[model samples]
Target chain A: MTIAPDRLSPFQDEFYSALMQAHEGLTEAQSHALNARLVLMMANRIGDLDSLVDILKTARSYEHG
Target chain B: MAYDYTPFPYVSPPGLTAPEARHRVVIVGAGPIGLAMAIDLAQRGVASVVLDDNNVVSVGSRAICWAKRTLEIFDRLGVGERMLAKGVTWKIGRQFHGAEEVYSFDLLPEEGHKYPAFINLQQYYAEEYLVDRARDFPELIDLRFKNKVVAHEDRGNHVALTVETPEGTYSLQTEYLLACDGAGSATRERMGLDFTGQTFQEQFLIADIEMDESPFGPDPVPERWFWFDPPFHAGKSALLHAQPDNIYRIDLQLDVDADGKAEAAPEKVIPRIKAIVGDKPFRLDWVSVYKFRCIKLDRFVHNRVIFVGDSAHVVSPFGARGGNGGIQDIDNLGWKLVAVLAGEADERLIETYHDERSHGSAENILNSSRATNFMTPKTPIEALFRAEVLRLAHDQPFARKLLNSGRLSVPCSLEGFPLQTPGTGAVPSGRAVVDAPINGPEGDGWLLEQVQTGGFTLVGFGDVQLPEVDGIARVGINQRSADYPCFTALKGLAIRRYGEGRAYLFRPDGHVCASFTAPEADAILAARARAMGAELEPSR
Candidate 1:
């Protein structure tokens, strides 16, 4: 049973705003550090090393593909 | 068949020549939101003078999608059943990437709830029903048609309004002023408040065509079909919805350079309709070409005047959030205004209305703006991401989850508010009441209908005894308990929705204020006091 009709990310605007807010005051070097810490925090929350690695590889693949 | 645009009779008011006595509340605008505002206030036993610039109901099938939560609020105001009986009820929605269907969903899988997930009824019919319902309290709801508000000023504790009519002009004084006007609110314009948000330049053709043919295959039982770049209309999105009277609402995206007047013409629109629905003979019931903006006022409440519906917040129509959101605004504002008017609470209660509904409107704006942005991306990068998502959505399930087509309106959760007791249960505080079917002394009835609209209701489920509190009605739900005005859950539906051994406190607007595992007198009273915004902070 589909609980909500739109399976899409209904929160695109919400997450986009949050991302901009997170980078609002940070410099380029600080932003890199923030991104790294954010990724690690999210990975820890996910707690699945295999899926995390797969997503990490997928992110890198998007740069060239 | 086109809806008859018969204007309502506009009787000349005595105030046409002489100044009238100060009214408690004056609502400007007679659209669905404004009419419903009058009805909701009347239901709460507070009288309001509803003034509209126009006498007729809305011109077209504008704001057609009424969500389930809005239905509950409408039921409280005494017009839910009428709209339900006339509206086309649909729970199924199918999304498509080109000709292939990506996903189909059933919004409400389980039964026993009072209303359906959504209903499609023209805004005119809903407003007519609300106007008729308002007549039920003829003494309270003084609906004046063809009355226009030329200007207004908030006089510290009261507001003075200069109104113009066909006969002449008159002045009115009221304790509070309510702007239930449409998106182009005269009150909002006059106030010159900041209505900041994104405005999309792309045009959309909204046509209500009446044809005996069904769009949803054969056996069309009211369903929503959305297509992204259909074969008939390439490189543009299209939506088809069924309403009552064999009329269908079709929305097609037009490019930024599309001519508004030329597109609305029959020569241009007929081919589009014929393209969508092959040889189905149809008549154009109503047609318009428009662009929507998702904008909102910085504050809904400004001194003695308050804004509700499109006047306070406007959203793109894709998600069916516009009218439904306005209904929610009225539902939130009704009892608070009544309380403040009756001197039952401090004026501070109005501030909570601002807090809760502003949060609600912001959420609506965000969802709608995101959907608009996705549909008509201004930047090439945004368009690429959207197209990729749509393309991958054809096969990849994860990508299908990224397709945004207007998240339908649902009640906003006011979880972290100061009014709530701040605890967890099946349904936590500050969230609207979710309905369940129940069997009681009156036979079969829904849980939402059993609760009070303008007063506090304490509902205890399964073996839980409710505390006797003042101004709060008591309700107990069990399989067999009939001792203290209790209801039999019949098949334990209420128990499923609301777990056993917990008592819930519902405010007048049918939103939960607090919940307790055990009956506590002091805690319940304190929470009630906070919800009313009457008493000062109790040594917090």
Candidate 2:
């Protein structure tokens, strides 16, 4: 699911751009490794995965619907 | 008596004549954690009194790195912007073996948080900011400095404390006491809690020095610079951190015995710096020798006295996580205390604090140990392993993981918390949807943006209305454009992917409470009521 640049709010664009820049030079494997760690770290920070899953499913449905 | 014939120059306020009845909650320390608890309590309309022995905030540097999550908390308190303005943001960090740069990682990319990359401001400045904020709530909070808790007796209903003030001794009665009183917590000791952990074998020297020549390469960035190799103190590592005012805080591992007890001298540190940077003139600002230890109280709370910050847990400062972790402990406990005090939740919520925060502390200690293991290789075999890992990190993904895992500044969630339900079905990890750019209905940033509020926030993505509980606040976002105005300026990214009719409830302290599809209002309210510990029926 690719987020469209035009649809992104100002802060969104800045964050997306920065994130891309952070991963710019890394290979796919490196990026994936970093992403996996980030996923766990973020999960820990947010603390509730069941709720987050509900959020993700809702977002995905919104896109597909 | 004869001289008293003249009227007094000034009459004190009526309330001043007698010490106001002791507050319900008395925080024994006015350090950052103590002040933070006071602020949180005051915000919840809970009366609190904070007492500190020191008259002035500490002058020398202590903790340097403020994690992204902490910055978010500061933002809620309206001080994060000022901190971000004064502090340096570091996103990229490099690992060194001797003078060689081995592995580098970018911390900014994967952290969907809307705050800056990690910020570096001296611990004193952070405390000063918190103290200044506390001054605004004079009525709700009483901040007494130079007053020490000489004695405390936990009476069944209230804790009676005898404090020494400049004038004389006075007695205070408070329902609960919080010890934010550093590692040498008298309250913790008084409660007879056992602190369990191991202390490092060697001692470390920390110095704040003004370098005449920059040790950083051209296009210098503020990062954790590590030097791992011999001669500069064999089997020891040096860390250079750029602080404000052109001062750099340097940490050097020293070859000293467990009983080594020497004050950090510039002569010893300068010669070591000369070994690495080749004889550059520098001025020493402050220096201290510290022995690293990893210890945590068996329990965080005893009777009515609770421990926060260093009193509860102490970890090595290798990852710069100790003080930051300490602040987070209070942040997690603050709201729970409010809930318990306000009768919004049961005392059971307080027990989860130790369970969750101890887990976090354990993780932080683990990460710090990893960094220490790599930076200060104790054994020759370990040294060889570190060297080989660094060499492979140049091209290998696993090497990057080993190196990046050492930084360990990410916030841990409480999904697996014993008190939390595992959920009826598969839980969404929030990773796949993280990159999507969906905004809140009111144009607030996104799911990540809401996490910064520093408490439980329930985000209703659709037009669904949630039954209100006393302590919980519900925000409904229905705007098609993901530009919620409330969170437009915050530091986290917007969620770009989600189903239209979904809603999520977040726990106070920035954890997800629960999520649901379009459900009957009754079920949602019941779940919330149970989670928040509200009586099934309203009180008459």
Candidate 3:
């Protein structure tokens, strides 16, 4: 339920910038679409069903927190 | 400089003047596959006739990426070392998004193997090498250039072929006919067989350019460079590979509606080259426009005729599977065909060729198809996914793994196939033998070279004394004091790859059929029998 330590440790800012730049020219709908696709893609990269389920719960909990 | 396409001398065949005796095997098309098939058969003390319409090696750098597994197979056919020596060896692959590099992967990080991950030698060179090697067994391999197979008939026990030579058309007969006639297979066409698969509409423009300056920047090293939405060619994918003789292969994705004729023209192609190479002086060696097609025949075997290479199946060139898979088909079929012809194995054994290779081709098709989809996304949603995947890959390790310009070709595991007796070990059953360095009483040599020349091999590792099995060659590793041929596992690589105190049974094609922790003669015999299709079940 926790992010791996130093997941993006050295390139944290670069990753954040790249993530923002991905949606730079897109409209709100387009940005949403890109994010949706990114989520699905990242989920597939994760690959494990159990890990994805836990990550989903953790993500929802963070939203309320 | 471009390759000189020197045509092989065509001689008048005996069939032109009079009918010849029935050959054991007749291989159609003298391309890489046909030449390799002939060489493989000749090596096993079997004679074969190789016929081709063209005398010269294939034009252009059609297939440049020779995978390690395919190289090993070629090594067995006696041309691997030559091809490797002439090829531009490369292992690293870099994927870029626009101007920024997303990631790079090292295909062969670990050493101690005979061949590298890949070598970029043009198909023409490969065909030439195979032709020369085939000539080594002149008496066994009757290579008839400029002789085309116009028609062939399956006459129950044997197949009769009508070959059209420069002199005149003549009749020839063979116990088995091997069709290596490529994608537009005349053999398959004449037989009226069903060739089916998906075709992607997206077209790609491929060109081979000769340049003094390196496109890979200062002090350039030969490596596969792939670009997605490159700055030079916006909104399109491009690929660059280095070949021998200062030649570079550049493939740029084109619009689906783009005319191949117009796109391939120098007028259109020169500018595209300029955009990528940037004002660098370069000469165009070859230019071509091709659409992706993943097609294959329903069955590779039909009566007395067997299909090999592109004649059996076709896939997109992205994965370099087309030529590699074809070479593998020869590797699997060569031994079985020899055994069957020698009356050592049942005729049913040839059917396993279809079983194993069809599965291998299907795997190749599936992989190439998936890579094509990723490179050229079809639907809008698919495009979105691809775009995001590329975007995320810039810094994300997880996303980087998802980046696939093309998943390069590797040996297809034949695990659980009909011929293999199921067993588990470091090498495992039905997997191609992994090469390692070893020092024999004679001299230092490669493991594959020692065991994979021909016939069943029983390889014992560490202190395990090899059991004597009739008709099988026994090799002991790290048994310095043994009587038969033995090797000292250099740096313990052999023992590391194949576990200590274990033994392995390898097929004639250099595939592991069974492994044992305890060396038993009976178990080895049974595994050998299974690998020979003695216990073969009814066709699936």
Tell me how far the alpha carbon of residue B108 in candidate 3 is from the true structure, in angstroms, after superposition: 1.1
TM-score of chain B of 2: 0.85
lDDT per residue for candidate 3 within B13-84, as digits (tens), equals: 998887899999999999999999999999999999999999999999999999999999998888999999
Residue B324 in model 3: lDDT: 97
Q: What lDDT is reached at residue B382 by model 2?
A: 47
- The sequence of per-residue lDDT tens digits that candidate 1 reaches over residues B136-180 is 998998989989999999998899999999988899999999999
| Ten-residue region with minimum lDDT total, candidate 1 chain B | B531-540
TM-score of chain B taken alone, every candidate: 0.97, 0.85, 0.99
Model 2 over residues B1-540: C-alpha lDDT tens digits?
001122112212222246657568999888778988888777767888888876766556788788777776676566777788888788777777555676676777654445666888877778788888887898987888777898998886678888776566777888888989988888877777787677777677888776755666546778877766544556567777887766677777777563334446555667766665666667777777887787888778666788888999888887767877877787778888888887777777776677778888887876676555556555444444456555545444444455432464766666655434234322332111122223443553444545445445555554444445444455555533432332222232232233445556555565554566654456556555555545323321
Note the chain A TM-score of all models in turn. 0.79, 0.61, 0.87
Query: Model 1: clashing residue pairs?
Result: A8-B401
**Model with the higher lDDT, candidate 1 or 3:** 3
Full ranking by DockQ: 1, 3, 2
Please identify model 3 stretches exceeding 4 Å from their true place.
A1-65, B538-540
TM-score per candidate: 0.91, 0.77, 0.91
TM-score ranking, best first: 3, 1, 2
